[model samples]
Target: MTARATADSEERAPWLPMVGLFLAQMLMSFNVAALPVSIGGMVEDFGVPPTAVSTAIVTYGLMVAALVMVGAKIGQRVGWLLVFRVVVAAFAGSALMMVLSPSVAWVIAAQAVAGASAAIIVPALVALIAANYRGTQQATAVGSLGSARALSGVSAFLIGGTLGTFVGWPPVFVIVLVLAVAVFLFSFRLRSAAGNKSVDIDVLAALLIGAAIVALTLGFNNLNGWGLLQATREAPFDVLGLSPAPLLVLVGIILGQGFLVWTRYRTGAGKVPLVSLSVLGSSRERAAVYAMFIVVALEAALNFTVPLYIQIVQGRTPFDTSLAMLPFNLTVFITATLVVRSYERFSPRVIGVFSFMLTTLALLWLSFVVTNNWETVPTILGLIVFGIGQGALVTLVFNVLVTAAPKELAGDVGSVRGTTQNLASAVGTAVAGAMLVGILSLNVGQAVINDVDIPDRLIAQVDLDQVNFVSNDQLREVLTRTDASEAEVDAAVRINTDARLRALKLGLLILAGVSALAILPASRLPGYRPGEIPETLVARDGPTGPDRDRSTDGTVLEK
Candidate 1:
């Protein structure tokens, strides 16, 4: 009798609703991709160091990691359509705040709101797909989420870079506002799902998991600014003569264990838990997670390092940053979308190993070939190779994990993916920041000591230990206060430039080693053939046979 409700039922599996979902995914990822490119502009506008912008990046990721599970439960309780639309509106508000943010602090606050919106949006996207589609269509929709993310990265670098270079950094978020409104309007095409009023929110488990993420994020994030093990001058407090960073990390680990123990207890009592432990209960699943963590972390590190080098060290525009990074971003988008087509031909384990090797080789080659110029042919080729590897791994591991689980648990899989990805991103960016600054300090001190032209007094005038990424113009401004001759300023500039390049090269080598070591986990991935997602409840170890053989193995169909 109702026309609107009938139309909603008739438009089942329409492209419009999927467009809304894809744009939502893009809205979240594009903001993140653009942030790094705008680092130079933000630093110039706010008159802050690069670490300030880095902290904002970490803040956004930490918020998502801390709240995504809870966001999922809230979505189920309040109804997906209602929750999704509300967050989209809130996301628009956050974008407006970002556009008007007068200081870096406001920028951080805006991203905090955006991250909170995304916590719900990430899980909601998967839940919507499950509710709307079935069979091969459902699988394709799920796979598209990965491509949407990669494509948004490409769009962000191009669009955000152009705006940041010619216009201003504030305008980068204008696209987010536009997309949020568009998604909100098209969201009506999605089928409606009723809220489950009986679902209980697990508060204790929430606190434990949230605490664990905060402590871990803070501990890793402060390693460079605060002392890794001992008290540094920048540290806020120490624990019994030891730095609080390690103590916080220890606390985080303890809380994480506590959360797991509590989950087991809750499961025994037949009470709903924050996250289903069974998602990662098997070794195959755990290996998939480990592999996911490595690729995501490497991605975060490179994303941060490349922009910092281009903008601050080389004094390039964000548009130039876009052009320089375009080869990799475009390659990743293409590879992620096409990688799924190869699953039926090759096993995931085989593809994973090959991809990681490509990434490792690319990083090593880049470390050697990267000079002051990013437009060089060797650098472009290395980026393209790395992109292909990185993009393939991202899609493959995600497919392996999602397919291995039952279809009903897709929401849990999405939540796990979001948490692992954002947490790894936070850790990756923080670790890279710490590693680069730590290396830069070491090199600068050595260079200062070895070269008699730069005076010790000049080093004392500014805090050398608190070094952050700065442009040559910023460095020149700082030198204006010091009583230095023209030759002294030139010597300091050359020394800083050389030290930065050396530190970058060494840092890449370390990351290359990290990527190479990731092969151990990749080798542990399940030996399932392509296009085979086990539908039945697998053995505690994992399924041994292909999809068709899974039925006769006495495997119970999961509820």
Candidate 2:
């Protein structure tokens, strides 16, 4: 049977079913990429602060991360195809709500709906691929999903920015609505297996994991707002004068440990766990997870910092931000699509190590040569180099995870991927923001104490203690309200500009150090090349399933 299937695959690749899967991935990516572009317009329309709009983004990630494990179980209980179509329809409704939303609260609610749908879709994509394709074709299918993400990001930034500027923010989401309907139409061409009615969801496991994810995400997301260690004015509640953010993170870790203990207990008792521990059974698989987390966190940090420097510090428009980022995004899209060709030539361990080296080098180069202007040739080259590494790592680690697990556990692998990505993203953004602000404050304070051009009175007039990332123009405007002479104002603006630049450069250096450390885990990836995935795939029961031996794609092999 496996021989016949292999011969059939050699004759024709299953490209048709992949179209729907690719589009489904793009549907989610596009919505997320469009958010930052639409922020300005959303603020204008809803008459709310930008923070209110950002809450919607946070809400979306929180929901997806919190429910993804439960969602994977639900997909196993119900069918992937049926649930996928239903979620696509639900996502379309969220888009419609975005178009008709009357207030900021409505927008937040709409994203929550979209997030729930995405939770199921994330895991289902992996499961469906496992069911539909085999071997090389399955590898190609996996790479295509990465390309879809990069392509969607590029498209969303360019298209969403244009639409928001010329048409309106509401019209940006209309594309989402159209894409959802198109994906629903395309889904008819794909195939899925029947759901297992005997699958049971452990409620206690679900609560433990979900609460842990929620607390972790919120804790990281609010590190800057609520303070990292001490309580801040923005903190809603504190414990013994300490910030709730770190406490929440500590609590999340404890809960996560408890969940793992419970899962081990369940598995030993011969009951099905929410996610089979076997999916992460080997050191190689665990290494893949670690590498994935580091790469994703690095990507998220760069994504947040670049736009922040361009738009906020340089006072550029969203269109300008898109244009500046085009090189990096386009490079990522191209590399992710083509990196699979190299799999035939290199082992996973080699590729992983080489990719991390590229990322580390790129960040170090950027730290030294990057200017305030993102469009400069040196800066663009550095971004392109980093993109190549990032694109390859994302696809490679994902393929490792997919090939390592059995067909029945593909959904679990997907859930793990989604959780890692969302958590890394939140943590990356928060750390970058906090780190830059802290560096800027240190630099500003030194300047004030040493530079004789500025006086104590000038510092006292403005809130120097809470100094933020601001542009020269903004600083000057604030200084104008004070009874200061031209020399004092000029000195203050110079300090602000220099401090911001120094902070950005130092932050990139720190990120480079992180990328350098990631090579350790990358070296531990499987030493086998493409088509050499191990024969010891784990089953729901133990080391092997009841049926005959199967390929990574779930096709039965000759016994």
Candidate 3:
């Protein structure tokens, strides 16, 4: 063998640094997953409604989405390693705050801090991986990030559920603190390029993008409460006669367009843009972004819907929620880790298409077979099938984006990925809730009007206009205060049960349709597979090229 080839064969990247990156990812995921698990404890402790606790979850996601672009630019200007370590320590502090929170307000504030820290950590993961690994090793590292996400989901649900049930909710966040500390210590092993002092921060671009993301996240999150069209009583404000939610969404879209226009102008003027548009320059890269958004959104919707059913509708415990979701979460973890092996055999285009097909079929199966009992054989099988698809797609689209960008612009790529994912998650969860509730309202209203057993007095006792998902037992309890006869109570309970099941089935069918539609974008993934894209093609959309230093052994180094 040639001397260079021999040297290359001998130089293997150590896997120790990856442990730190993995833990960093899990720290964020676990914190988010633990929120719902501890909702009951939080509600009891604070004497607030469950929606108050949910606001904390929304706050974290909104903060992350709003500031991630700015975070990426900051990381590039300030060294990634320095910023990463600082943010990891900050995350640890946030966990401590969570453990000692005196009120729901403090809990929200703690998550806000954690979200700000995560905004930096998200992009840092990509840049760090590029700094530490190359070729096959880099591919493994990228796939491991996806596995870490899946593994964290399972761990958070199982561990947080047990701890919250037996000990208390505060102990759950202690795990996050331990994880952050471990990541901080292990971070010493990672290598990063020096910060580029010349890189400019586009303040205008930051404001425009930040405002747009905030508006979009809030609009989507409040669609059900604020009203999808006309004004609802819960709406804080209205635009003319319509709900402010849709108006905010429209304004967000306009601001997003302005940001893009400003970015193109800035890039053409030879000034540093907030993010390099080159990340989305190619058709394949754009396709990867689209696929990533859809998959993440679908995953978020399922995560929200399943637990909402188990905990609220069926009145099951958090541990039961964990058990019901075990099959899907475990399958996702296994699939994400193993899918890297198939990259050598099948192209991204093939994998993307196949995965979408699997998701579509799985959702269709779920729509037909799912019942209130999530532990049923057919329901579990459907979840596993969906998990396989979700796992493969998550890793596949991420790898595609990672390979398409030159090492110098890895942070920008990371920012784009973060923005798409966070936005998609918000949209997915909002749409699912709105769609299901809307359907339920219709089903209940129609059933009440058509049933001959229902009397006007009983109907007047309930505010049909404020209908939402409630259990049969909850409905019965409410009716007890009224002079509802046994037959009337039974009728109301039957109507609620049928309406909820119908709504769930229809919602699943709608999600299946969305998965089917996403196949168009999946078809556009790269037709070829490579361990890593060549720098020549990656640099085609921008001025950046082979501008980084090379070691004496001729290995490409991060810049």
For residue 304, give model 1's deviation from the true position in Å: 1.0
Candidate 2 wrongly placed segments (more than 4 Å): 1-13, 533-559
For TM-score, candidate 1 versus 2, the one ahead is 2
Q: Report how far off residue 502 is in candidate 3 (Å).
A: 0.7
Encode model 3's per-residue lDDT on 90-193: one tens digit a residue: 99999999999999999999999999999999999999998888766777789999999999999999999999999999999999999999999999999999
Q: For model 2, how does the per-residue alpha-carbon lDDT over 1-559 read when each residue is reduced to its tens digit?
A: 0122333445355588889999999999999999999999999988899999999999999989988888999999998889999999999999999999999899999999999999999999999998888677878889889999999999999999899889999998999999999999988988889899999999999999999998998888888889889988899999999999999999999999999999999999999999887777767778889999999999999999999998999999888888888999999899999998887668888999999999999999999998888889999999999999999999999988887677888999999998988898898888888888888989999988899998888778887668789888888888889998999999888888888889999999999999999999999887656534344532233343223233334432222
lDDT, candidate 1, 247-314, per-residue tens: 88889899999999998899889998888777676566677799899999999899878878887777
- Considering summed lDDT, which 10 consecutive residues are worst modelled in model 2? 1-10
> Which of candidates 1 and 3 is the stronger one according to lDDT?
3
RMSD list, candidates in order? 6.2, 3.4, 4.1
**lDDT values of the candidates?**
0.80, 0.88, 0.88
Candidates sorted on lDDT, descending: 3, 2, 1
Ranking by TM-score: 2, 3, 1
What TM-score do all the candidates reach, one by one? 0.86, 0.95, 0.94
- Tell me the deviation in Å of residue 256 in model 2: 1.0
